[model samples]
Structure formats: C-alpha cells, structure tokens
Target: MASISSLGVGSGLDAESIVTKLMAVEKLPLTRLTTRTAGYNAKISAYGAISSALATLKTAANAFYSTKTNLLTSTVSDATVASATSGTSASSGTYALEISQLAKAHSLSSRVAGASETMGTGSLAISNGSNSFSVTIDSTNNTLAGIRDAINASSTNTSVRANILTDTSGARLVLTSKETGASNTISIAVTDNDGNNTDAYNVLSNTNPGLSQLSFTAGGNNLTQVQAAQNAQVKLDNVDLSFSSNTVVDAIPGVTLKLTKENVGTPATVTIARDSTGIKKVADDFVKAYNDLHSTIVKNTAANPSTTLSTSTDAASTASALTGDSTARSIDRQMREALRTVPSGVTGALTQLADAGISIDSSGVMSVDATKFQKAVDTNFSGLQSMMDGYGKAVNTLVTTLTDTNGVISARTTGLKDSIKLLDNQKEMLNNRLTSIEKRYRARFSSLDTMISGMQTTSTFLTQQIAKM
Candidate 1:
C-alpha cells in the first residue's frame, strides 16, 4: 500500500483543517481553566489592596491608644532670659522664673610668650574635677602652638580644651574646662625638666622657662585664671535653686528650662498648658484612616446594580474584583460591627465615640463635629481621652485579627493561590491529553486518504475493460 505524503492530496478531503477544528474544540477545557485561574489571581490582588489599607488603619488606631493625654505646650514671657519645654508629666501651671546667674566654665591662660618660643621639656599633669590626663612636652612639641595641639589630641583629655590666644602681649596657651561648675575648675601640675617649677614669679616672666609656665596648681602660679567656673542660680517663686549647667531639667517637673541670660530683678513666667490643636489633629487622623479603609472595602466588595443595557461602562461594574466573595463580605461585616458595638469598661458622660463628637454616617464614612469635639475636649478632656482609648483599642484588635499572618484576608489569599495552582495542574493534564487525541485524528485521516486513493484506481481499471468488449 502507498503512503499519503500530504493530508488531503489522495482523498480530496481537508483533513488538516478538520484536525485543527477538532483540536480547537478539545482545548475548550484548558481555556476554561486558564480563565478560572486568572479570576483567582484577581481576587488575590484585591485582598492585597485590602490588607494594605487595613494596616494603615491599624497604625492610626494604635496612636489613639498610646496618647495618654492632650500634648502640652510651654511658653516663656522672656524668651531672651529663658526658654522652656514641657513633657507628658507636666501639669498645667505658671511659674515665675528668675535667673540670677548663668553657668560659666573655668578658663586659664599661660604666661605670654613668643608664638613659636619653646618652653623647657617636661610632663604637665592636668585635671578638671576628678578627670586627669598628662601631656609630655619634648623638643619637637615644646612651643606654644605645639603644646596646644598636643593637649587637644590627648585621647584621655576629656575635661579641658586647649587653644593658643595671641594678643599685643604675645601668644598665650588658654585652657578651658569642658563643663560648667566650680568643681570642674582646671589645675595643671608640672614636672619641669629644668628643675625650677616655682622660679617664674610673674605672668610675664619667661626667664626661669620650663613647662611650669603652663602650671596653674597651688604649688605654682605661672598660669592666671581668666574665668571662674560657677553654677547657674535661679529663683522659682521665691525658692532658690542652683544647677551646674544652664540647661535645667530636674528643677521643674516634666519641664526643661534653658537659661540664656540673667534677669535677676525681672522674672519670666513659664506657662505649661494642654495643646488643643494637637488633640484635634489626632482625632482627625483617626477618622480619615477609618474612612480610607472603609472606602477600599466598599470598592472591592460592591455589586453591580441590575442594568438593562448589555454594554455599560459604569464604575460599579468595573470596581468589583471580589464581588460576592465570602471573605470580603465577612471583613466588611466585622468592621461595621466593630463601629456599632459600644466599647466596654468605658466610663463618664463621653463613653462612646459618638459622645466624643465622632460619628459614622449612613454611607459608612466617619465625620467629626468640630464644635462638639472641642467642647468635649475643653469640658471633659479626661472623659474624651478615655473614649478615644477605648475605641482605639477595639479597632486595633479587630484590624490586627483581619490583617495578621493567619488573618481572614491572608487565609482567603492562600486559598485563592491553591485554587490557581490546582487549575494550572489541570490545564497541564488537559493539554497533554489533547496532544494525544490530535495525533490519533491525524493518523486515522491519513489512512482513510490512502484507502480512498486505491479505490479510485480500481474503478478506473474496470471502466477501461468494459469499453474494449
């Protein structure tokens, strides 16, 4: 028997076209599986958007629970004399603050000498309060500039800073205590290699030259005290208080006072009070966050209203990614329930969010009544705080459960993913089966074409024999 080279040459049948059409029908199941998988992916993406919105809402809700009271703001009548800041521990009150003295750091100067003149080589032991460090002077670093650099570069020299000051007299090595306080006064003891530490009697004496010129200890008077270390003294309501530093924090409860200048006779009033603006801002943020989350849920779960027109470009139809989905519906229902339920363990006239001037409208959007909210904050701030705390705790708990690792949204997403995976596996199996079916169809058509060609040849032979007779 002869084999058919082309599909339809012998039988005059369009076998290739027929096989293609049959394969198209056979692929219907794969196409359906792909479409279903795409739908599942869309649902998963919709859940992701919902989770992000819920996370934002959770942050805003947590803020309300954390803020214990209205934020406090402080002011000073004389900002030039002093500035103040208040913290959560501060109580609303006014204090008459009188700054008699600002803190000063101790500064000492070495006897004037030539800018590049070298003093005798030795080691100088320097101290401020309990901190002490020694600087060695050699021929290489014996000059005034060299001594300044050596003192500053000492790794353990934490209490004092050294600098070279040039005047009409000459160059002087100036040492200043790094901190304020009489106890932080600087003292320098010298081991003069020249063997005469007390030989220099006057500030201008360079004759008995040695490292003793830089000493300011009781045994030597080579260095002069330029500035005295003193404490900052202030009077709060006729009570005297002193601090080692100008920035006073412990003197006032929950308040830090920064003394800039002395105003002994004239006292500045420091007032700390509740900040109404800050409270209102927090309330507004909470409402806005809830509205955003609510909007997202509504958009994802909204059903398209019945329409007579077949072709419609309405947003309602386009926005439905998880429409009729049980997970989306459950989340929406739980959130609405949280809003309607009254928070437990709350007391006072403003026990609920509505009582504190926060209300949800029929459209599921929250609104704040500014006048009412401010009135509640002014008259019953404690009550308003309690209500916010209660509501915030409740909302935070609900949002956490919904967006956590094993949350409803996460579970739904996981289920959708598993469904897509199954659909993909099914699609693979269906495609493999369709391949085998197409091969069988092609083999049968080729055999039929060869058989028909042989029959046509036999018919032609019989007609030739009859014509001869």
Candidate 2:
C-alpha cells in the first residue's frame, strides 16, 4: 500500500482531499435537520404546515364534541316521588330537593343446587391419564387457604376455587369444578374418607356468582358481604344519592344524583334538569375556549412585528388570510356570538354573558365571577337557558365552515401543504447540485496529485544525474 506522500507526493494533500469528501457526507444529515440547508430541503415546510393544520382541525373537532348546544332540559315528567331530592347552591340555602321519581331495583338471588361435603386430599388429575397433582393433608389443610393452594398446584390451567357458604353453624367450603361447559364439577367418589362418602366429601356448586358470599379475616379485617352492582352507586362523600329518571346525568360532576317528586306537591314534579352549577360551568368553558381561540389567532396573525407570536412567513400569511378572509372571519364571528348568546327562556340576573357576570378583557379574554354567575343560574335558570339557545346551531355551522374539507381553515391548510411540497422539491434538487459541485472538486484534486507525482519523479532523476557528474 502506497501512501499519498510515497507516490512521489511531498505532502499528504490527496489524503486531505479524501477528508474533505467525507465531510460532505457528514453534512447531508445535518442539512436535513436544519433550515440552514434551506433551498435543498424538499417540501418539509409544507409538510409542517399541513401537519399543524391537521392538528388544529382535530383540536377544534374535539372542542366541538365537548360542547353541547342542546338545552340541559331533561324533564322528570312522571315519577313515584316518594321523597324528592333537589340540588342546592351553596349561595342560597336553596339546597332543598324534590325527587321527580323514585329509584328502582331488582332483588337478586340464585336457584343453585346444594352440595355434598368431601374431605382432605386426592390425586386430582385433569383428563390426561399420567398428568396429576397430589394433595397432602396434615390436619391444618382443612382451612380454605390450604385447599386453594393444593388446587392451584394441580397443574391444570384450571384453579381449585372455593366459596364460603353461610348457615346457622359457620362457614363451609364450596369448591368449584374447573373445566368448562357445565359438566365440570368436583366429584368425590368415596375414594378414602374413613369409608363413608357422606362424611368425607361435599361436591361444591357453581350456580351463583361462584362464591357470592365470601368474607375472610386477612390482617384481622372482617370483610363484609354486599351485593356489588356494575355501575357505581351515586353518592356525595358516601351520602347515598337517589336520582329521578328525568334527571340530567352530567348535572353532577364525578357523581350521580336521583330525581323524584318529594318536595314538589301532588305529581312529585322534581325538576330533573341540568344543575345550575354544571350549566354555568359549561357556559363558562365555552366562553373561555372561544376567547382563547380568538386570541391565539390574533396573536399569530397580527401585523405587529413586536409581538412574541409566530410571525414566520407561512404563519404570518396564514394569520392574515384567516383574519381578513371571509370564511375564517365569518366563522370566527359566529363563534363569538355563540358564546355570547343567551337562552331565550332564561331570566333573573345577567341574561347575556355579561349578565352571567362574564366579561371579556381588552386582550380578548373572558373573566367571570364565580359567585355571581352561580347565583343567577340557581334562581332563574330558565332565563339563562334562553340565552344559550341559538349558539349550538351556530357552532355546528361554524365547525362545518372551518374544518370541513372545503372550509376556510381546511382550504388554507391544504394550500400551505402543497406550497411546502414544491419548496422541498426545489431544495432536494439544489442539494444534488451541491453534491456534484463537491465531487468535481475532489476529481480535480485527484488529477493534481497525479501531476505532482510525475514532476517529483522527474526531479529525483535529474538530481541523481547531477550527483553522478
């Protein structure tokens, strides 16, 4: 192997040329990661724009879903209002509730067959002839835990589960048959229980919720038996809550309350409607979301260069188009009105957003008084509902206008994506051009090294001739 210097080349300049060529390869990935590699990057900017637009559209869609324009108007028309319950606002001691309907339930019990008792251990084997596990009893094995462990160790995917049955005497072990499809059962065939099958084993029953009533003392805590229902029972810190059938479900946050006609006379008319607090919260949320979106758009698109909001060329263009463009502007206007509109049927304090005690600051943000807004809803709920009427329809229309494939936001985003794609294509071509330029430079250096090597050989031969002279 000849080094560049050994090839009649005085300096390792050709080696430096290889180093420079390698540097170009290292820059390829770096260029991809940064905008400094600008002109050569394919439509990354457009891709970024489209991705952002998609994200915004999805976010807006989610907001639309969270919003409910329909009236929180669940009416408890009929009910056996044994004792009606109504929610109370912390504002006025008006927590007095009238149940619109009584709660209903079904008594639960099973018609399972009784069992025969069986004792200690046997070579319990699943269907396979040689596959089996043996149980050893040292008298202490009579306990439930011991039986459970023995069955589990039996090697079958099936477990030896036990249910404790209650009778006048005490708890008795009810073992289950592990196989599936009804025929699986524990069969005690008088193998060796002091000769009598009756004294030795009792076959367990699988009829009920396997072991519906099992209580054990683990660490001295006595677990009680109670019927557990699939749905959580509604309660406020454990105060059993009853709800009327006509009650609005979301009126309670993280809880359920019953409706019945208790306080309201004759027909037990409990207003199974949205709780004032919950409704106000929703209204407040809508106001905040609308305002937040408005502010974000304004900041992003604002003509002022001093603002900290993103005003990059693409972002600025989008902002301008959104603010001035009729579709974006129109939809934005509708959303604004939707948040401000009041339910026609509502009355009492603060009819409009202003009356609900909500106000927008100069920066286009909403602020509201928690106490005052709640009080207005509690006393005159219908009036408040009246104000919120048209907003739902308006929002649906706005969402369609902004997020639909042909909507304003969608159109702008699509255009941005296309433009970015084109820009990126141009960038890729430029990069290939740069690679060609660098490669040509390396080839020129290779030719120069060859020329230098030839000259060095000729000079060495001349020097030898002079020495001979």
Candidate 3:
C-alpha cells in the first residue's frame, strides 16, 4: 500500500477514513431524499388501493341497477304468465297462456332411381347395358339399410331409397333419376342373389314402375288432407278470430292462445288467458339483485360489509346499511323518487315498478314482500312496472360515476399517479444535488489531506536539522 503521505501528496486526503467520514456527512441529504421518495410511493399505493376498490364497487352497482330495472321492465311487457291455464283469462282461479306455431310439411318428388341398388336382404348384380357392378347387402354389420343405401352406393349416376307409403293401395317401386334435370332418367337391370326372391329385380324409374304407396302409422298430426287450412273459429275475449297454428297467437293484450287438442276426439280448442310468470320472475330477480347491492354496501362501509345474520336468529338481516353513512339511505330515497317519476311515451301491459311490487326500504336497500309481490302480479302488474320505470334515468346518472374518464375512481387514481410522478422527479433532483455536494466535499477533503502532508514533511526536515546541530 502507498504511504498515507503519498496519498496526501497525490489527491490531498491524508487517510481514506477522512474521505469516508466527509462523504457520509454529505450523503445525509440524499438519505433524506430517499426517505421522501419512499413516503411518496406509499401514499401512491394507498390511493391506488382506494381507487381500485371503488372501481369494483361501481361495477357491482351498475349490474345491480341493470338487473332490477330490466326485471321490472320485462315483467311489465313480457307475455309469459304461469298459473294461468291454456284458455280463458282469470276465468279459472289459476291459469296460464301459451301460443303455438304451425308445423311445416314437405313432399318428395318421385324421380327415377338412376343408380343401381340391392333390395330386401340380397347380393344384387346391376348392369346398365355395358357398365355393371355387384353389391352385397348387409344391415347389421354395415350401417347400410333399405334400398336407398344400396342404390346410393351404386354408380355416381344412380341412387336408391325407400318410400314411406309403400303398403298404400297405390304402392309401387318408384326410383328417381339422380340427374332428372340433365340425364332425366336412370336404368337399373339387377340380378338378385337373395335365396327366396329372384324375380324382385326390377329397373326403377318413373316409366317402368312407380314405387308403391307408403303404409305406416300417421303421427298425431294426421296426414289426412283438409280442403282448407284447419282452423277453429274462437272468441278471444269476445273477439272472433281463426286459430290455425299451435302456441295460439294472442289476438289482444294480456292474453295467450294455445292448441289444446289435435284432430278427432274433441274439437281442438284455443285457450286465451293472462300471463304472470314474467312479472313474478322480475320481482324475484329484483329482490335477489337488491340484496346483492345491499350486501356490497354493508361490506364496504359497515362494521362489516359481509355481515350475514344467522339462520337460527329470531330475525335474519342482510348486511345492507351503507358504509356508516346515512347518505346511503338518502341515496335510496333518491332512487325511489327516480323510480316514481315516469317519463312519457311508455307502451304495453304494466306501466310502473310500483305496479309490479318493487319498493325501497329506509335503509336504501330494496326489499320485496313475496306475498305483496305475487299479489301485484295477480292484481296490477302495470303498477309494479311503473315503479321500475322510475329508475331508468337515475341509474344512468349513477353509472357515469364509474366511467374511465371523469369517473370517481378514475379521477382519484390519475391524480395519485401524477403525484407519484412528481415525487419521483423530486427524488431525482435531490439525488443530483446531493451528488454535487458529495463531489465538493471530496474536493475539500483532498485539499485538507495535502495541507496535513505538507506539515508532516516540514516536521521531519526540522527534526533532521536539529539532530545535525
């Protein structure tokens, strides 16, 4: 190692310890800056936490609002009502309505089976003049079945199939030409190898022999052709209309028509009645959603946001009160006011939420009485609908608080981020200034070391001179 005196002559520090001590003293400002930065970061993190929590809460609020309002809206306008029978609105103590749609039927065009086919348990050889091939028929081992599978397996020009009405009085083997538009006809000359049926080989075509009429059980909708469209002349609420399709179409409001019978036994009747399922479902969904919102509020601001009362308790209350703020209750009052105010231009069935039986409690949470709810469904659904209608504009307003721009969470988060950036800038400035201070301190230490080394050398020279004397 170089001598301490050499260190002093070179850079001015008599010893490294002197440089270290001064440097530590100069670093104090930097240490203070670092502490400030740490504090800033912590504040930013806390603000971020609050912003994120609010964002989530805002989302839950939106869903809760949408569900309750939609349920109310649907309950008012929807056509579904349970407990009402197929016909007669409220004529029976409990009844529902269902409308039926007509079924579509299709007919097949009889064309020549141009391709060759094996029929009725047999290995058949097919020849159309020069071109010929033999096909073995098997149902159990091979997925192939009936004459249709065999002919389809034949040459590309020909095809095979089965007719449903084969046993009918006009039954005939009518094979269709694959290319009826171009080729127009198919010729099949076959040699059957089934043990008992040798004479069954016949060329299938429109000219040779028509496939026999089909013989089978007809479905509930009889194939029997009617001269005109089958319809029942019925009075829907004293209004006369023809019922032709199933799921009876409603001729008027608050009614559903349905087919109670098909063909024969009794004259198929059309039932007209009121529907209540839509309203009841709305009320149920509203209750569930309201409870969810109430729970969220209680959890976030309550002694506990997630307080759930024990089932064994004499009274079970959901955690619903807003975070220690009675304002939450005020908010509910505002929501109720919003619900009560119905804008014009409403249409169909139920008109309001109150008509449908949705109400708010003093605590700001919605609470539904099932009995009152069902009674409203049974008696006046439009009133409940009106109550739901009041919330539309208000909900829209509340949802704005959650938007990414100008939203409660967004604004706060953005401000925090900016503060963090500023803090970071401040920290960098502090570091730069401290670095300059440290450099200055180092320079001063170098000068002090030089002075000390000069003194030490002078002392040595004096000692030597004095010894000579």
Candidate 4:
C-alpha cells in the first residue's frame, strides 16, 4: 500500500535499489539492440567510403573514352604576331604564317556640331554593303544624344555603332563599322522634312559633286576619317590569303589563327603535334586510381591476427567497419577479375593489359612501365587504345552496377539503415516493457516493506506488554 519512495522508510529496506537492479536485468535486450545499431551504422559508413573511392575510379576511367584523350597541342613561334589553337582534327605539322595586314574597322566622325543642338526632324538611311536600315529622327530625338540612342535602339542597325565625341571644338557624331571586312563599308543618306534647314544632315555628310554620307574628302564639312576598314591579309606557307576577320579558322585545316599585329615581313611558325605528355598523364592517373581502389578493398576486407592469439581477431584488422562482409568480399573479387581478365574481341600477342605495360603486384597494387608502354604505343597505338577502351568499359560497367540507384552498395546501405530503424523500434519496445516491469517490482517491494513494518510493530508491542506483567 506504501509508495515506492516511502517503502524504505517503513521497513528500513533499500526498495528503490532493488527495483533498479531488477530493471537493469529486464533491459538486457535494449543493450543488444544498441550494439546492433552501432554495427549497422559502421557498415553504412564503410559503404560510403567505398562509394567515394569508386567515384574517383569512375572519373579516371571516363578519361579514356574522351576524344581529347589523344589531344594535340599547338604553339606559335611569334606570339607577338599571332596565336594558334588546335582541335581533335588537327595533325602534327608546321606552317610559316605571315600577317601582311590586320583587319580594321571602318570609323567616321561628323563635322563639329553643338552637343545639345537638334538635328531636325528627318530620317537617316545607313547601309553596310549588303544590308540597309533607316533611323527616324523626330522632334523628341533630333539632338545628337537622342540620335545616338535611337541608332542603338534600332533592331536592324546591326553593322554600325554610334557615339558622340566631345572635344574643345565642340561635339561630333562618330559612326564605326561593326565588322572588319572591306566589303562591310559604311554609307549614309539623309531625308529631310524641313528641306531648307537640313543642318543636322549637312554637318555629318560630305557635300561634294556627288554628295555621300560616308566620304571624308574635300567639300565635306571637315568630316575626318579615324580608321578605314581593311580585310586581314595573311600568307600561309608563301601563299597569299585574305580573311574578313582576324580570327581565321579556315586558313589551315583543323587550326584556328588569331592575328594579333601586322608583320609584313616577319613570319610566325605554327606547329601542331600529338600531346604525348597529356596521354601519359592520363595513363598515370588511371594506374594510381586503380591502385587506390585496390588498396582500399584490401585494407577493409583482410583479416588480422596480430592483436590476439586468434587469427579471426577483429580489433587488429584495418577494416573494422567492413570486416568479414560478403558484399565487400564480392566487390574485391570482381575488381580483381576485371584487372586480370583480358577483354574479348581481340586477337594478338598484345591483347592483355600486361602487354600494354600495366601490371599488378602481389600486394594488389598496379603500376605502369613508361618505357614499355611507350614502345607498345609507338608500335601499336590502335591496339593500346582498344585495350584501354575495353578495360575502361569493364571497369565503368562494374562501377555503375555497384554505385547506381539500385546498386549493391546503395541497397546495402539502405538495408543497414532499415536495420538500424528496426533496432531503434526494438529498443523502444524493450524500454517500455522494462518501465512496466520496474513499476511492478516497486509495487511488490512496497507491499512487502509495509507488511514487514506492521509485523515488527506487533512484536514490539507484545514485548512491552510482557515486561509490564
């Protein structure tokens, strides 16, 4: 009938301590569940490490499939005159390139005119060789600044740019051709609504016998030429060629030339060659990545007996998280098989990876012999390429299977997580049962303590009665 807190006071017994000991015994299942959850978490972490290593290996494997794997490098002898770039289609060759002329943009400036002065209501027709467009100059946009804005806003005004140049003399309207070819010439004509007062158009046009908007000759209103339009002149291997743009790609096959400055006499040598260094680096990276993956597998799956008398001791093993795991073992075995087995569809003495100078040691580490690889590549480049392609394909396929959405690694991690969730649920249920058991133990102990207290009180009263008699 007594409460748990008052049980010890009634009979001088440690009832709460006894209930704690009973609850400890009842919570054994919770400890097991906790240990299992920890194991599952460790396995998930181990799978994560494997996934990261596989991702690195996949990247290295993908490099072999790239067209740029046998990429070419280009160099220009005189960088001051020009620069060069090569693509996959480029072959190893040399060319003597001379830049006779650099492409120039056509620039023209109007005669001195007040910056704020209105040009009057009219339309100005502008042409760039093949295409012609008009800009309407209304009262709102008749000023120099307004006309500049209007020209920029015209959708059809693609070949020319307009700017107002302010000097000590006054402000002038400058028009420049957007393109750099001689064919891209600038021409302009004015149509005035106020025929007599065409000051805006006159200030910017040449008033010669045949008045033109682009000419900067005498009889013009002091209109000056800033820079004339010129086509880029180049001599490739002594043959003259002209280009509309300084950036020429068609001058040489699979090569793009960027002309920097005009060198009438000086020639810049351009060369394109196979990039052996790049190819070798890719091969080196593959070997390193392969070795890294192999090492990780060995470290995680191998057993250690140094820690104790038992050869199956887990404490001394490097892969505590993944020790004795079947999935880990399977991954290691598959990777080893991929490395050892030669790809199918090849018939030659150089069919295996060892023929290409890629060798694996007893410790599961891979290395490439540079001299042997170079000799193999020089003799049979196609064979080497095919071998790497086959090997990369096999590795890529295996990696994808293990790392994909429904992959073994992913599924295993998910399973472990689910197991941990189950363990958590089990722990919760065990804790609930233990809580109930503790409450029952306390209730029973409290009742026993109350009964003992009552019996002792009865014994004490009887002894007092005997003494009085």
lDDT of 2 by residue, 329-352 (tens): 454465566556664444555456
What tens-digit string does per-residue lDDT give for candidate 3 at 63-153? 4334333332111112322111222222322222232222222223322343332223445443322344555555431211345455555
Q: What is candidate 2's local distance difference test score?
A: 0.44
- TM-score of model 2 relative to the true fold? 0.44
- In model 2, state the lDDT of residue 242: 44
**How far off is residue 466 in model 2, in Å?**
3.0
User: RMSDs, each prediction?
Assistant: 5.7, 13.9, 14.7, 4.9
TM-score of each: 0.73, 0.44, 0.38, 0.80
For all candidates, what are the clash counts? 0, 54, 69, 0
Question: Top model by TM-score, which number?
Answer: 4
All models: lDDT? 0.83, 0.44, 0.43, 0.76
lDDT of 4 by residue, 1-469 (tens): 4454665778889887888787777777787678668778877877888888899998988886453536567889988998888865676799999988999888888766666665556677778867788888777877677878888889998888999989798877788898998988777666666555434335442231111232343333334677877899999999999998999995778889999998878788998877777777878988888887877776666655444524432343343667778998788778879878887765576777888788987877889889988887677766776777778778888899999999999888898999899888888888888878888887888888888888888999999999999
Top candidate by lDDT: 1
Q: What's the residue-level lDDT of 335 in candidate 1?
A: 79
Q: Report the poorest 10 consecutive residues by lDDT, candidate 1.
A: 307-316
Where model 1 places Cα greater than 4 Å from the true spot, the runs are 1-30, 68-70, 109-124, 133-159, 162-174, 193-209, 218-221, 224-226, 264-266, 307-319, 325-345, 361-363, 397-469
Q: What TM-score would you give candidate 4 relative to the actual structure?
A: 0.80
lDDT agreement of model 1 with the native: 0.83
* Worst-scoring 10-residue span by lDDT in model 4: 205-214
lDDT of 1 by residue, 62-162 (tens): 87776554467889998899899886577789999998989999999877787687577788898998899999988898788888999999999988998
lDDT of 4: 0.76
